[model samples]
Target: MTKIAITGASGFVGQTLAKKLIETSPDAQLILADVHQPPNPTKSSNVECIAADLTEASACQSLVSRSPDAVYILHGIMSSGSEADLELGLKVNFDSVRNLLDTIRVERPATKVIFTSSCAVFGRAAVKDVASEADIVPYPESSYGTQKLMIEFLINDYSRKGLIDGRVVRLPTIFVRAGAPTAAASSFVSGIVREPLHGQESELPVDPNIGIWLSSPRTLAHNLVHAMNVPADKFGHFRTVLLPGYSATSGEILDALEKVAGKEVRSLVKEKRDENIQRVVLSWPAKYDTSRARGLGFTEDVGLEQTIKDFMEADK
Candidate 1:
């Protein structure tokens, strides 16, 4: 049986990924680790949930002790939260991850490591409406982005040295999460859809025309799983990939929401701009050339309308 370990398994994205893996890979055993005890929603013996504070060296070693064939590194502070607290961000997002890598290097050498990074790693200088694999150079504009970038380089170096087989997939803002708002700068992206659908007033922090790159949680899990089975040679010495996602403005996303739900539901969104949030959100590149990722067996979600419809169907 294929054994996979996923850190941050208590978070929304982590839980979604775990569910997806269980649905798609019945034979795969999973080790779900987090500071809070991760739930075994499936209640199957194949899935193991552990309470772990990964910042601790012992915790990292213990998680890696499972000797999984692959590891998905998904734990980190949200954008706005990290941006607000530099020391905390550095410790969790950067130092803790480095410790985890070290544990993997020693305990599970050459294991496949799929890390979920963010498009925020690309600031205004690295983008002009569109960013591609060839022309892009990351200069993170926020603490969260900076932390992610540092880990990206470490993963690349570790992979180059054959210490670990690493694949860094830079994620776009994930939308329509099935929970309350998070501390992320882009939480409003999902709030506008989720809150209204659940009969609550949603906040719009950016202009309607401000565009952002986005992916659905379901599609992201699929691509992350696909990343593991990809041949190490297919990475061709550079293991990082910008996961495929479509770009759309706030207005367009709300329009899709309206189409999926109704005008009354859409009208529940209340616009109240926050300059800091806008500045942070605007720095992220909304479009990418994901041909390289697609070539490596990655995939993207359909359109905004379909995404909204899917959320509606699932929320029911």
Candidate 2:
């Protein structure tokens, strides 16, 4: 049986990915590792949930001791959290990742490592400036972005040295996230839509015209699983792939929501701009040319309207 290990299994993406894995690969052994127990742990006999402090070397070693065929490295501090607490960001985002890589190098060298990176790697750029596979010189502005870029470089180096088979996918802002507000600067992206639809007031922390590259939770989860399954040969030299996503401004998102849920829901979003959040959000590249990822069979959401509709249906 194929053994797959997923760190940060308690997070939204991890939980969804775990369920997807259980559905698609019932016989596969799934080792779910997180500091806290997964909110919705699977009942399947093939799945094992283990509480782990990824920042601790011993915990990382224990997580990889079983030599899983594939490992999904999904743990990290969010954007604003990292910016607010630089030391904790470095510890969790960089130090923990390094420890995990070291453990994998020593214990399971050939195991496939799928890492979830973010579009934050790109510095402030115009909406017309579309990032592509060839243009991945990360000029990160936030501490969180810096950590992700550093880890990406490390993953690439490790993969080059044949120490591990690493695949990094720089995810766009995942919207309609199911949960309360997170520490991420981009949390407003989801909050505006999610809260309003739930009959709650949501705050918009940036200008209505500020654009962002976005992906639905469903699409992001599918791409993560697809990244794990793709042949190593498909990635050639560079291991990083910028996943496909569409661009939409905050105004457009609200417009789509209004179209789907009605004008009242859109009116529930209150504008209270936070400079810190705006700075971080604006620094991210708002456009992308994910031709490489598309050719590699990574999926994209249909559009903002469909994505919002999907969120509504999923929540109901």
lDDT of each: 0.88, 0.88
Residue ranges of candidate 1 with Cα displaced over 4 Å: none
- The candidate scoring highest on TM-score is 1
lDDT of 1 by residue, 1-316 (tens): 9999999998888888888888888888999999999988675689999999988999998888888999999999989889889898999999999999999998889998999898888898866746866578888888898999899999999999999999998998897677778889999999999999999998898999998888987788888788887899998978888889998999999999888789999999999999988988878887888888889888878778878887888888
Which ten contiguous residues of candidate 1 have the minimum total lDDT?
A: 126-135
- How many residue pairs clash (N, CA or C atoms closer than 3 angstroms) in each of the candidate models, in the order given? 0, 0
Give one digit per residue, the lDDT tens place, for model 2 in 18-137: 988887888889998889866545668888888899899899889888789999999999988998999999999999999999899888897899999988888864334778868656
Q: Give the TM-score of candidate 2.
A: 0.96
Candidate 2 residue 124 Cα shift, in angstroms, is 1.8
Deviation in Å, model 2, residue 119 alpha carbon: 0.9
Q: What lDDT does candidate 1 reach at residue 11?
A: 88
